[model samples]
Target: MTIDTQSQRAEHSPLRRIFGSVFAILQTRLELIGIELAEEKDRLLGVLFLGLDAMMLATMALIALTALVAIAFWDTYRWQSLAGITVVYAIAALVCALKARNGLVNSPIVFEATLAEFEKDREIFRKP
Candidate 1:
């Protein structure tokens, strides 16, 4: 009887309860992190495929347009027309590169929600 009673008391001890609560919180946070990671992965893959498709189409259009422009000025100013087109393309490439750099630099942090949840947990634990 005494052994059974002690066992029951130990199972329902405050320390055990605290540990269980902490484990539950950790499990919930881990699940949240997993969900956020999956979402980010999906978003990144979508952007990657769309961006590649757009770039391919744009490159085809630009090539066709460049050929047309060069043919239009072939007899009179062939070299000059090609040079002008090359310069314009170079400038546009530079602008796009700069914008891409800025976008990467300014992009939101990954796992933002996970970090926030951890911070909240820290705050909760810090209180008496």
Candidate 2:
């Protein structure tokens, strides 16, 4: 009787290779996701810290500057100067709001690369 070990081994090789490649692709995708998550976390933390610092410092400066201006021009331009500052602040706030809105509208959704990869996979698997 002939032992048919070579054909038996050959029959399984392609299946084993396919599984191995799938696992490798999955691992690479997961690693990409992890890297993106870390970057987003860092960006969020930095924004929070910077925003908090800006708010606190700005509050103190605005109060002190307003008092100084009103006191310095107690009789002549107190109201005018205060009104001007208010207008400037309002304009700044509006500009910031618009910029934030635009930023959100333009930003890419999360896992964009992974989604693209999955779509490519789907197309590949669908081909005859």
CA lDDT, candidate 2, residue 52: 89
Off by over 4 Å in 2: 1-23
Tens digit per residue, CA lDDT, model 2, 41-122: 8988998899889989988998898888879888998889899888987898899789989988998788788878878877
Local distance difference test, each candidate: 0.94, 0.86
What's model 1's lDDT at 86?
A: 92
Clashes of 1: 0
Candidate 1, residue 46: lDDT: 100
Q: How well does each candidate superpose onto the true structure, as a TM-score?
A: 0.90, 0.71
Model 1 worst lDDT window (10 residues): 10-19
99 in model 1: Cα distance from truth in Å?
Answer: 0.9
- Model 2 residue 54 CA deviation (Å) reads 2.5
Question: When superposed on Cα atoms, how far off is each prediction in RMSD?
Answer: 2.0, 3.3
